[model samples]
Target: MGQGEPGDLTGRAFPLGDWGRPAERLDELYRWVERGALETAAWYLADRTGKRRGARVLRGGAAAGAVAGAALPLLDMTGVVGGVAPWGYLALLLGVACVAADRYFGVTSGWMRDVATAQAVQRRLQVLQFDWASESVREVLGPAEGTAGEAAERCLLVLRRFSEDVTELVRAETADWMVEFRTGSAPLGIQAGGVAGGRAAEGAVVPGRLGVPPGGTRPNMPRQRPPEAR
Candidate 1:
């Protein structure tokens, strides 16, 4: 879409002069996601058609060759003694060849599946990044006065959540649990956890923290309150 008006949702403009580096980094991440998706789809298609077709052809050829070889033995084994025996030998050879070919080609399916899954994970991460970028832009345009600190806070919150979601997505896809989140690439060095104690007090809500107005709570949502006396 056209980067709409400066403050328009469609435009979602950031201070290009300041956010240029981070913006570029974000774009790079998006590209990676898109590429990964394409690669995954390719792997899937090859696994489904190319690999299976190759295996089928190889198996059929091996079977035919085996039957021919076995026929000669069978003839020799009959009164010629070479007939039936040769046929049996040929059949055994063909069976082994077919099995071996299938085993070799079968590997492609698993490998492609793994590659597809990895790409899917990357795509999920990209989606999270896109959402974070959009949300950050909207927050900046909210009623709250946009300042460096406010922008930073908004960025930090979004980054923190995005990182967590990505980490979880990776773990889910790979079945290996690990939590690793980086913030260097994020705008304003916004990380999941709060800033260091020495740098700023914990939970210190800066004025810039107020980006968008807090939307009205849902009517059915339960409001968390302090525990009452027993």
Candidate 2:
């Protein structure tokens, strides 16, 4: 881990400094991709889990509210609980409000999109690793039409390009998430034309809901073409 050293990545030592030594750089590049992909997966998994729970809570609250409202009128009409219908209606309103808030704030949609993105990224990493292994074998067994170093350089180019693509995609996702946090809107997967005219774009992030922001609240980045699968 010293400066200029790729360090003991796994069991192999990646040589640093030597453009003539693209094999080591290629290995290091793969390592970077693996590390970034794993980190990305973990972070989004946490996010997905948290938001999923929030979504369940919201759905339950809404259902409960609806039941209370419907049964209150019947209970009051039956005279078993006279004059309780108003309270029942109020409770229902509260429940509906909670659900509405959840939808508008994009709690459910955010989790789904992020989880999907995480899975996709993880799959890409797996493919990249597989390809790297295949290329390594090829380099070993294939005729030396090009020098080993030349082959390594080609591998570096491919790996670096793929790595950049992944990084940009993840970064774009984060930027969108930040905007959602600030603006309190979901990514259209949650609320698509059923209620509020498909515009659930208002709310503040509660503390401990996502992560604690600096000032404790904001609901909610940019558009980017999704990366192509390699």
Candidate 3:
């Protein structure tokens, strides 16, 4: 066997095969992953904001309607119905309108769908980032049963396929939303709610994960930077 430095592989910043093709291709892949992560983050923020606001509006409307309805009979019994009956009726109508807006007009549903899509994208990004950090390109792309050059080529091929898959997934998700927006069909919230109800009926409901995954670090991956560096 040829002699080489013992720490050569262990000391490198990345686990890619070499400094030539695999390194270059992996660098490009990392750039694309970083961009996708940024876009997903923005989408997630917008969806989360919309979801919270919509929920608040729905709850407020329900509370207002309840208070008004409860007071109507009391006002009538006290012989003061004439003064407040109209306002109570008006409040009830406003509450009904708000509920209809949330349910039928797709405000709440749209946000729900966006949030789900954003979360899916975020999960994919996390998987890719974790793989990049912990696994060598050869191991990720294949069984790592070949020479360095063959591994590099396999790595490139796998990255290409992964890139295409990610692109297609994102395109399909965005297109689905666009179609809903254009045609005014059921948004993701309503569909997911239906499925959830079905599952509950069948005793198959499962809770979702609520904890954050472990984080990773890489250059050019948007995170808090030191003030001097910024």
Candidate 4:
């Protein structure tokens, strides 16, 4: 990395007001992890509630258009809607529009990305908690390792590392999402009727595509920032 800006993940400050206070270190770590996890979870819910519905609706629309297009031609055999010629074209257009909308919005890809990010964050949170426990054990087993200040710094190091890891994960996810929005990522196809796009919209549910995931928020507690490493 060249000169890091304040906005750069590694350079950002996580001010820990009471980080050095012996009584508040545990609380501070808890606060830091919870806040990061909360934002990540909110994204998961937003996509579950919003974008997911839109994807489903678009897919349903494409299906409906396909049905109408198929039927209209048969109906034309029986002389319906003046002739199937115009009606068939309209149905075909509807399918294309729905498919195109699905691809352009990227709702399907978005939810998958959010879910993956949320799961990744959860795994890290688990690792942080376990690390805290491991460190506590080490402290008990060998408190004579160094001075009190050194011990506090050790705790600070743990907190700092956890905070940085979470920050980097979230920042990377958000950046990729923004870039995807600014410049589209057309899949293997964007041809007539957007057959590829329609497949993409429906692809989320296609079993092997998404893989396993993560969950469950911790209880409510007063928030605190992770200790800033000196």
Q: Highest lDDT among the candidates is held by which one?
A: 2
- The lDDT per prediction is 0.40, 0.57, 0.49, 0.54
TM-score of each: 0.35, 0.67, 0.57, 0.63
RMSD of candidate 2 to true structure, Å: 12.5
A best-first ranking of the candidates according to their lDDT comes to 2, 4, 3, 1
Q: Write the per-residue lDDT of candidate 2 for residues 1-230, one digit (tens) a residue.
A: 01122211212123356666666666766776577556556656766777888888998889899999899988999999899999899989989897888867777767765666566556656667777888888887994587776777677765655554444444444445555665667543221111211112122111112111011112333568999999
Model 3 regions lying over 4 Å from their true place: 1-21, 77-82, 137-144, 161-165, 175-179, 182-185, 189-230
What is the alpha-carbon lDDT of model 2 when measured against the actual structure?
Answer: 0.57
Estimate, for each residue in 1-230, the C-alpha lDDT of model 3 and write its tens digit: 00132321221132334556666766766665456444544544554675668768886997798688668756966997567777777778888877776665556655655565455546655666665655474465655466767755755654444444344333333444444556555434212111111111111101111101111111244788678954
Which of candidates 1 and 3 reaches a greater lDDT? 3
| TM-score winner, 1 or 2 | 2
Q: Assess the local accuracy of residue 119 in candidate 1 as a C-alpha lDDT between 0 and 100.
A: 46
Judge candidate 3 at residue 76 and give its lDDT: 69
Best by TM-score: 2
For model 2, state the Cα shift of residue 115 in Å: 0.8
Q: What tens digits encode model 1's per-residue C-alpha lDDT throughout 1-230?
A: 01122321221122233355654554554444444334433433443455456656766767776776666666675666533675667666877777665554343333333343334434544655677667557655763666655655565555445333333322232221011111111011112222111121122111111010011111245879999999
In angstroms, what RMSD does candidate 1 have relative to the true structure? 17.9
Model 1 / residue 58 / CA error / Å: 3.9
For model 3, where is the 10-residue window of minimal lDDT?
Answer: 204-213
Q: TM-score for model 1? A: 0.35
